[model samples]
Target: MLRLGNPRRRIGIGLMAMTFVLSIFAGRLIQLQGLDSKVYAAKAAEQRVQEERLPARRGSITDVKGHELALTLEAREIFVDPSEIPDDRRDQVATILAKELNATKQTILAKLADRTSRYQQIAAAADPAAAQRIMAHDLKGVGSKHRYRRDYPGGDLAGTLLGFVGTDGTGLAGLESTYDRLLAGRDGKQIIETGRQGQRIPMTHSTLLAPIEGRDVRLTIDRDVQWAAQKVIADQVEATGSRTGSVIVMDVRTGQVVAMANAPELDLGNWMAAAGADRVNRSVTDVFEPGSTNKVITAAAALESGAVRPETPFTVPDQIRCADQVLKDSHPHPVERLTFSGVVATSSNVGTILATQRIGDEKLHSMLQRFGFGTRPGTGLPGEEAGLLPDWKDWSGSQRCTIAYGQGVSVTALQTASVYQTIANGGVRVTPQVVAGTTGENGAFTASPPAKRTRVISERTAREVSAMLEAAVSEGGTGNLASIDGYRVAGKTGTAMRYDTRCQGYCGYTATFVGFAPADKPRLVVLAVLQDPQEGHYGGEIAAPVFKKVMTFALKSGKIPPTGTRPSPVRIRAGE
Candidate 1:
């Protein structure tokens, strides 16, 4: 009854309720604007402030003496800001940019037509001069960004060993790929303030995350020695018309690789222009039957097992039949008894087999293992192969005899060099190393120490073997071609038939030569391999001469003083 009498009062009460609701809504809005303003503002800034990555420059690679091998330089990438182009002059701008950037007109037009996109790349990497020329045009949409490009100043000298970088500025092969992480730098971030037109405002507050430069790598290679080795090998390969070849030089005392070269080397400046085979470092990758060059291992085995002495007598026959297989010497020799040294000097397959008979399969294989055969050399290079050496359990009747003269067993150039280095270093097997040290951007270097050595033979045995090797380079020996004018050399020549993939049998030959110099105090060990020489295919005719040239230059350039006199047999053993 009271509500029915007071209509005005009811209307006033409803208006009051509506006023209270509006006050509560206004209070909530003020709280949100004042209390949580920073939180909302930060979220909005994150949406508009794009953080861009700034890439750090990769480190440089140098030789042992800090000569640059691989380095990075600043390059440019051309792009276009589609939204910046004026509608009236879009066609003219597209036509000029397409021709200058080597892009099609249709492609450029399409990029300029995309009004929604702010930026579009025309070319990823262009020459600095070309990029500057395009910038001189002063087109509205045209832009350029800085990038890094890899360069090799040494050219093809150490190309196979240093390798090349890929299109993405990442390492792709050889030592480049093996140590990618250490050589590649970190990427940083930049938070920039933008204007109303989506342009970066100059002098605005910018938060930057600094980048870290990569660590520099120093190799054990000598650039001069490397160039000399390459020149020698390339000339030999061309003169002999060989399908492929490799040369390696090592320090006998420290096992440091002074030079490793190969023919058909890829030029890092234009790596893609060459074939894939040219990119391979044959010194550590390609394996072949070492032929008579492997006689060093057999001779060491016999000496270590006491199966034969340097002067021990044995008969050298023209041919010897062993278990369904017939073995023959390079030249037929009269069936006469000769000293063990004479057998090795002449490289008589029959004598090697006879000595193997005394040592048997077990002792011979054990000695081969000691010389770092049938296994990887652990040089820390990519695509390194462990040359095939069948286990003793897998040896067939004739396989044993074949392996004695280096017929069945296979080895890489590095493995062969390591064998000679062991003998040169007084029978201690030291692992070969390619990297010398790694340096930080702060100019501090962490060097790699000398490799650990394991004794494989008595020092007496090493001296006897050294004398026998000297005899091999003497007059009337197979490796006489390896002799130098002023210095005495000790080396062995190898000519083994390669297994023809098409013929399914041994057809073409692989020529090889491995030896040490000075005949008394060996400083360097050199190994050369030629695959399928068109001219005469013997190691003496093809590989030994190349070895002579490289060894002579290495000794002279290293300034190693000559021993002056031929070492007496008594003096050789006395040092041990």
Candidate 2:
């Protein structure tokens, strides 16, 4: 104490300085250990572990006959850590991958030579078969991740109807888009250990999460029937020099759309680049004036409302005055007296107009609505259009009369087919079923319950209308070619004039034939429409044979035996 004059002061100052130093050190410790612990730990973990994505398998789509229409196959995606390859072996690895993965050699070499990158995509959606060949060589810096690639077994058969998926395994159109959620399963993940050199550690313990495979989709489409319908429609369109065509084979009893086919189809493999015009599901999406095919609806309305009977006679004329406009038959001839049934059999525009005059527009529109017109068929397909049925209030005098003969109203091909189905099913308008149901991983299927049916007309009226349609396909009738040799056929011929886009006048024509086979004991109802045939414009000539071809296939495919009854003779005289 004597040696240092301010010993107490020196001790007090030293203690205070030590306390300040300790306080600063404590603050730094708290900041690093408590406040930023997670941040540092995350940084360390990110560097130590490698994240790999595990893709899930998409579901399969099969036909009603269990034929595989679409499915997903195990595919391999080649990825690489460029730094792991020896300089001399880079070219060798690239060559092997190029040959197996259908990739350019130069592209694969560039990825292999980049020593700075730890990850690079060499090939995506590679075929498992080819990937196996590559892995057999055991090349360095190369690895594969399993994924699912979409496969269409029925190539271009029902291409437009099945639709396709995107690069990331997402559905883009048709039934794929309609039920994508059910088909795309959940993805999994993997966490792997890595060395300080930024390379995966060999035999290191890692965490993994399992993936869930997607559920399957079962469609009502019959592969055999769909193939036959497509071939028949395609051949007919080419033979008639028509622009395009579609055919729908529906079960009258269940409204199950067995086969829906369209021509001018787009490519299913690369749908994104396909022509927009040809990509439509035309059977359910394209609308057109149904021509005389709609006359059956008018017949039902007349019979149900007691406006006329099948035997009721009307004066037949080549042309009749409908308000200020004159309506004429497709083929010009002298006026022939025909009964109401005869009017339908010949598809007489004047007779149909006269019949509509008795029922009036209000009654006629009600009947059309009841027969599943002016609305979508609820088939769960993408881009479906509810056919245009203008309100009676908006209908002009000409519109009212023209609609009776299947003009002034538009209908999609499905709606047109359903109208015949309604009459064929004893006047019960059963909603068409398309999707059927979805099958889960356990193989248990959850069905889409069918929509309730509504009665459109009385059974007696339906029977009379069916008989009238039968007469139309008889000898000397418009759709005579639609008749099978043994089975009784009932259908109508339609050759509606197409409206010019510029509204100048009618230019092109839409030929159509709608009918059902085994009319005595109905089974299948077929509708065929040919748009703007360059050769002939009559539905009887251009469209009826297509119906016959398709109907013959349907009856044979269904194993339906010949119904001995023949089509009733056509009545030419009105008073009979």
Candidate 3:
């Protein structure tokens, strides 16, 4: 429809347009391939490569006989990448995850709402089957990682002693916390290249370091004995409606703790659900007045210092005056002549005070320290409290006499048990030990060092105290309930006013009975303590029976036959 121009000129214009366009494309390609190559590659690498942690296997906790108490099992940690989940599909994916993984839908939805985060942990220690179910849905951004979960095979047995682990697999309490370094080992890591969907890119995985597995911790606790002790103490606590209770059984010669049981046991599998107070290992942590259980120490001091003999007589009455407090025997009685052994047999608070006057406060204080009072029992468990032992110089006027009768001084169940263990071991105090040995990652077994020993009294003094304790368990004595038919038993009963912080003073009673078997040749010492019992609060009434039950079991289990000799008659009445 128009006049034609020069054909060569039209062709040249078209060629010019095409050349400009190609030139611009070529420049851009060169810029991308050369000048900005490293920058783009770095950005791509940032999106494709990810660091992953390889969890180390936590060690096993076994009892003396190689019975596993706590262990680690393989598990999965489910996670989600909010960036990969579409806004419209987030609710659907969250719903699937909540149902399959047993997680809260609201929690999963909250994590899915954060589109900026590439990784959000949805659940830890998740069951492999649950993780598999989650993956079956092919929900975008949902994934899982290999993890190690801590499990207590015994459930609540020795739960507080074995302690618990945190979500990150770190020890949080008890022996687990005390020996975390040995049990946690070393965690390793790996770097891998991933695809757009966060899938592992084959042949691009590299482990930066290999994980080191934790070493096994072997404890001196006997699994069967522990179970028995726990059963008995837990039963007693329930029957008495006690606020708390504890039992300690020690190998007299070795100071190795056979069983340390507490009531309302901490169930390791559900440790988080337990209250903080219930989580404590009260045997070593809680402190209480020893009550009459401390009388044995007074007897030891008096016998050791040559201030009194088992036959020495004291004129005792219902009550005596000391400082501003009137010290009295547990029960009211008229003035009566009681021999030194008789005073112990009756658990006479007044007689003990009169006898304590002979050695004086300083000597008694020294004796308490020698018996491991006011010191850590060295059981190697976490939260071990050195019982409160005030220096004699700091004693209030009333404290002097009260402490003499086992009221002012505070001692832990372990410390009280150690006192009788000293007597049972013939006056030599062995440091209490919980851990027996350790098995290394390389499968090497190493035994714990020998327990430290100290002589608190002469063998003769220990024997004298032992005889007095035997008298205390004799017929018509305070702890007569602790007597066994076949074997001679020696022990003391204690009923002290419990100190309560909430009350800011004494509130309830702490009943205790500590004793050993085969009076002639003591082998094992068992101590049972009950705090704030609603029923009977007398050691002989409630606590002594527990001691007898545990001791009978331990004696029969250890096959320790009696000395085959009748207990020597100690005159309980002065006129006799």
Off by over 4 Å in 2: 1-37, 82-91, 106-117, 196-206, 500-505, 566-570
Best by TM-score: 3
- Model 3, residue 558: C-alpha shift (Å): 2.5
Per-residue lDDT tens digits for candidate 3, residues 127-210, read 888888888888878889899899898999998888998988889999999999999999999888988876789988555888
Candidate 1's TM-score = 0.87
> For each candidate, what TM-score against the reference?
0.87, 0.90, 0.92
- Which stretch of 10 consecutive residues in model 1 shows the poorest summed lDDT? 567-576
- Of candidate 3, the 10-residue stretch with the lowest lDDT total is 198-207
TM-score of 2: 0.90
Candidate 3 or 2, higher lDDT: 3
Candidate 3 similarity to native, TM-score? 0.92
lDDT per residue as tens, model 1, 1-576: 443657788889989998999889888877778888888889878756778777778889899889999988877888888888899988888777777778899988898889999888888777788788889988877888777777898888799899878888789998888888889878677889876456887887899998888789999999999999999999899998998899999999999999999987778888888888788888999888999988888888898888788877786788999889888888876786767888888888898888888888988889889898888998889989899988977899888898988988989999999999999888998999999989867879999987878898889999898888888887757888999887878889899989767788888899999899887888999999999889889998899999999999899889986777774442111112
Model 1 bad stretches (over 4 Å):
1-47, 86-117, 127-133, 196-198, 202-205, 567-576
Better of 1 and 2 by TM-score: 2
